[model samples]
Target: MTATTLHADLLGRQDPQMADVLAGEARRQAGTLQLIAAENFTSPAVLAALGSALVNKYAEGYPGSRYHGGCEYADLAERIATERACALFAAEHANVQPHSGSAAVLAAYAALLRPGDTVLAMGLPYGGHLTHGSPANFSGRWFDFVGYGVDAETGLIDYDEVQQLARAHRPKAVVCGSIAYPRHPEYSAFREIADEVGAYLIADAAHPIGLVAGGAAPSPLPYADVVCATTHKVLRGPRGGMLLCGAELAERIDRAVFPFSQGGAQMNSIAAKAVAFGEAATPAFGSYAHKVVANARTLAGALADQGFAITTGGTDTHLITADPAPLGVDGRAARQRLAAAGMVLDTCALPYGDQRGVRLGTAAVTTQGMGEDEMHRIAVLFGRALREEPSRTRTEVTELALQFPPYGQ
Candidate 1:
């Protein structure tokens, strides 16, 4: 059945209050711009899998070796998910059990290092994820972390600094990934640095994994010893995480995800992830992925024209990080104004300073069938929202969003 039919006939009939909440959220998503770098619209097939009976299963272990009984179908779903993930990413082994990207990173750490072991990763201020060793996170409390920063002038990863840090610290693991960096990571450089220091190369590929699937970004599979990723974002999958590794580490990775970090796997989410993986493997998805990057470049250029200082000058991926300071608003204030105008996004750290910048992506908009033209128009809306009354811009934003319904009426 269609989404509208499901909401009205089943959820609306059973629990009007909860249905109203969901309906409101649906309306908000449909009517507003979703420029959030990590958000996307999952396909109906993926949504169907997420709502399936597999959600009821409590499969606690790997396929064919479950702790609980009556997990045959659950086993099949996980197997298919793993197979597809492996094939798509060209990894020797795939583990599709981690609940989220952070969880996947945790599992990778559990499999590779012990408490107090030193790690080298991008600095949080430079776009590194929390799992990269934020003081508030478990990783920081347990492991000693050395951070690398980007070039102040170029907003690009400073490979020379990374190598120096790796040599000085001799960390147990070298993490390569970021939350807001808009360019493809030089995985080979990271690999070489890790090798020189006798460190394990861990790729926290949460954001770029989708682009990698679509052939729009380089794969970390060949360079990193462990690749951790989210299934959603530009992949258009359900919110979940997975791990890829060589055959030698497969058993350790599985154990880390199952008995160590997570208990029962979410079978329904796994099924949904499998469906997304299947969809991503198609030629159409490849075209869509490339367009995501193209739209982002267009958006970045347009935002620049509107006076936002685009990070890295432009994007090689779907994400774009820009400072709105030139428009007389900081990232936080800019996000608030944009939200009022019905445009949504996030704030991120700037490469060279204590101030933050705005982070946005083209994945959701492109998924809504918006092209480069829409990106340019969206940039114009951004200028209006920050300069004019938000209420006035809100009307125009909603009208534009409604033109390209994420799901058809």
Candidate 2:
């Protein structure tokens, strides 16, 4: 049976409209260039696991000591996910129960800090996530949050400044990671600063967990006190979160994620996460991760040659954050134009800057088996569209996208 037909058989009888929407999204993913740094296309095995019957179970507690019965299968899935997650990142322990990266961060905070403890993290405009220290988020409203930003001319993290802040504030936690920055974090340096100030170091590797697993980026498990990530980003798993730490803090993290922060876990997502971790452990995934970084650098260089100002001058990761002003377009306008041309990405806001920026990534394209050549062509199409030629760029984008259809569809 066809995909649509199978999907219809599953849901069309009860909810034809919802089935149509699902089919529409499937078509969109098959056609568009999904460049969101935090997005990726999962493998078919992962898709099957996500849609599995594991979702029917409700296990409110961890394996072997659940609050409900018939949890044997659920426990098995969670255990497998946890074991694979730990192995993939070389973490001593892994908790695959948190519903999202944000939730995992919250659980870590709950496990380690009180209601009004101090936290030092990069601010939202400075590439940090809302869960890190945005005043609009719970992490901000509950804790006393101090923000640190990158240097102006160099556009690099001011390690000296961070140390100064840590020395002054003596924060309960120091978070290292960013959502829009085009650079890899220095986890060891952050750990040093944390030690100096007696602060717990939380590394939010939500965006590059796959790269870490595949050896394209440094793993934070060896340095950070706690590491949390979303499975759906570069990991190509279901939409869920995983937290990792040393054996000493495993129980604390588990308790925080279970009875304290969230209740029953999403078993389907956990099963899918196990499948993803298994995939990431392979040599082929490692090569794919490296190619993602290479493609990003190539795309950034091509955009720079086409008159776009790349953030931090370049990228060493999957991200290519740039100010679209050089293309005579604002960040929002550039994002809209690109979307109109069938290319998808986000408009970024830089640290302590009013000007808008555009953030591009190569993870999704890499999943489609694309390489540096495709990145160069994507950059060309971006320039063409941003230069007020969406029609021509749209045609080119559609044609090029067909050459590397997502998920091999």
Best by lDDT: 1
- In candidate 1, list every pair of residues with a backbone clash: none
Tell me each candidate's RMSD, in Å, in order.
Answer: 1.0, 1.5
Per TM-score, the best of the predicted structures is 1
Model 1 vs truth, CA RMSD: 1.0
TM-score of each: 0.99, 0.97
Worst 10 residues of 2 by lDDT: 1-10
Instruction: Write model 1 residue lDDT over 293-341, tens digit each, in one string.
Output: 9999999999999999999999999999999999999999999999999
lDDT for each residue of candidate 2 in 31-118, tens digit (9 for 90 to 100): 6788988898888798889889997889999999999999989999988998988888888999999899999999899988998999
